[model samples]
Target: MQGIIDRQLDVLIYPEIGMDPMSVQLASLRLAPVQVATWGHPETTGLPTIDYYLSAEELEPPRAQENYTEQLITLPNLGCFYRPWGGEAIRLDLGKLGIDPRSPLLLCPGMPFKYARQHDWVFAEIARRLGRCQFVFFIPEVTNLAEALRRRLEAVFAQYGLNFDEYVIFIPWLNGPAFDGLLERADVFLDTIGFSGFNTAMQAVEQGSPIVTREGRFLRGRLASGILKRIGLQELIAGSEEDYISLAVKLIRDGEYRDRVRKRIETERHVLFEDMAPIRALENFLAKVAN
Candidate 1:
């Protein structure tokens, strides 16, 4: 705090305050004349000292300011200049990875905690609807939590008279080409319901994989929906849980439709990467704030 004061900073752009205890404490104090929060953690700071919340046009819903303590500044598009992950996609043998190549793979690539219990039935329902489909999950750093999540989902699948082991598969985390290959191989990418994925969704779109997402109530849950909206693929964004399941099933069952969506993604996905509008908006916002 003393160092910040000594520097006489005009503004403080604090990100991911929820992810760090010390940062939250610092954010609660008036370290600068203007303090702004962003969607690194994608929730309201709820601190009196924070003057503004930096969000994107596509990420927010109607009258989204009601959900924040700070005044919301909805920037253009996804509000970030993102570079596509430049990795060589190397296809791996599914048999060696203990996955059956015959079964259609549905990628659910969010952290285990993001899989809320209420949405657990989604996987089981999709499996019931598509009897031969398999859902792939990544075991994030929190290994025990991932295992716990698997157990929880197994219970849900059992209720539907589906064997979780047969339909659900959890593999170690992958990066670079491995992750890209997985996305490419997946028949459909299922975005987490309550909290959406920004980077993962972007990568999936880059891979031209069909993604089914629920446009969440808040920014945290609306990222993939925003991406889909930006690319004019609103049909892939679901308004309700039932719709989400149906979209996932449709993608898996109708290969032609899935191919159509993938081709659409290949055509429209260029607008999403290397965007400059968000950066220009930030610059303009900063100048206005500084004055």
Candidate 2:
């Protein structure tokens, strides 16, 4: 940027500005005449000349302005563009995974770092509310992190008077196809709090797996909510922590409601898969920024 940034470049976009020396130096340098940020970091860069912070309309909270310093540019009905990295969606038999065909399964899949301490109690409380239920969580990639999360959950469950060994099941991460298969069979997808999952939520929505989400004030926390909102599944999006618990429980207890939501999701899910409006919004933003 120090060498190439000049009057020739119309805009220089920083996808995410982490707390790193290089990003700070680059953002502080005003490398391009028009510098911008995006939803990657979900926070302000705080650099005076960093012109804009771009986010999708569906993913941003109403009071989003208070969270950022740059001029916020929101695009319509957009958040993530998901694609199959590898492997086709497979149909896995529950019997093979030691899962009973008749027992209900709740899938909680995400990174270890995204799992908050409070979430452990949430899971425990859910288990306490619904007896004779199984909560399945995907093992994190890192061995140590995976074990740490497992231990934390175990302790929390015990504290809540629920035996973790009897109620929780941990499945090691698998390839995309198999993972999708897991979603295909699961009853509900429990979203991560504070830091939501984008691609993971998309995959769950695509598979018609009912997800329970608590929308946050920040864009990062609203990633999955955007997907649910765009798909016309607002009923699945929880407004509060208690609402989240009720929604998840309802998805399990109310079979008819679950079926209605599942059917609606199956029919309305197409709209979220294809959206070209963001591209047009980008063109307009660039035209405006160029001037």
Candidate 3:
């Protein structure tokens, strides 16, 4: 088999989790002088050749950092890596989605079946509590493997007597203009906890949708909490299942609190997108490694 020729590469950056060991082994053998870095927290590769592990301010120091042998370089709070839409773009048309904008409540379930984030029960429970309000779910097309796993998830939903066809309103995945349109339609984005929704949660917040997240253990749980706190939305971070439910209920029922969070997010949107501190730090680190 052919090998990685070191002369062709200067640096290697792994963006997501789950790296193949063979790739690491091959890279180490040929790319010795080349720098390698990992981002998005998959714990460690246990490879001696990896030069650095990249993290964010949300990740607690010495914990995620301590577990890995590579030097840890922390990225400044980039808010969330979501594309932002201008304030003028936020539309108030829940009616088109078969929902009333004034309808006391709306639940934004951003869970994908592959991650075992079966929040069907939580949605149903919230619906039961809210009574008159509506719960909206974004149903994405499941991969074949995800579909197989979804059967078990469906059973859990059925046990609660919640039918997917009845509760979930389909919102096709959008990009560019369409994606902005979808974000403008929702009020609050409910984050998943069993495994958290990292990218989606940030996108929701960026588009002026307030995010309500439940804290969990390790990387997944801490991500949204970390981002919200950094952005001064700490009040929106819910710590338990009951807290999740209560916050959802309060955000819907209490007009004052809901308005406060909504306005705060709107005020912070520009600061989040234009902030260059994180970008500068990342560039500086990259330049140092490249040198």
Top candidate on TM-score is 1
lDDT of each: 0.92, 0.82, 0.62
* lDDT (Cα) of model 1: 0.92
Task: State residue 25's C-alpha deviation in candidate 2, in Å.
Answer: 4.8
List ranges where model 3 is wrong by over 4 Å.
Answer: 1-10, 17-34, 40-43, 79-111, 114-120, 139-154, 161-166, 287-291
Q: What are the per-residue Cα lDDT tens digits for candidate 2 across 56-146?
A: 8898878787788888888878734545333457999877776666767888888777888876788888788878678877776577877
TM-score (all chains, Cα) for each model: 0.98, 0.91, 0.76
Off by over 4 Å in 2: 1-8, 19-25, 79-88, 98-100
- Return the TM-score for candidate 2, rounded to 2 decimals: 0.91
lDDT string, candidate 1, 108-167, tens digits:
899998989888998899899999988899898779989988999999999999888999
Clashing pairs in 2: none
- When 2 and 3 are scored with TM-score, the better candidate is 2
lDDT of 3 at 163: 67
* Cα error, candidate 3, residue 230 (Å): 2.2
C-alpha RMSD for every candidate: 0.9, 2.4, 4.0
The parts of candidate 1 lying over 4 Å away from their true place are none
For residues 124-146, write the lDDT of model 3, one tens digit per residue: 57766766565565556654544
Candidate 1 TM-score, C-alpha based: 0.98
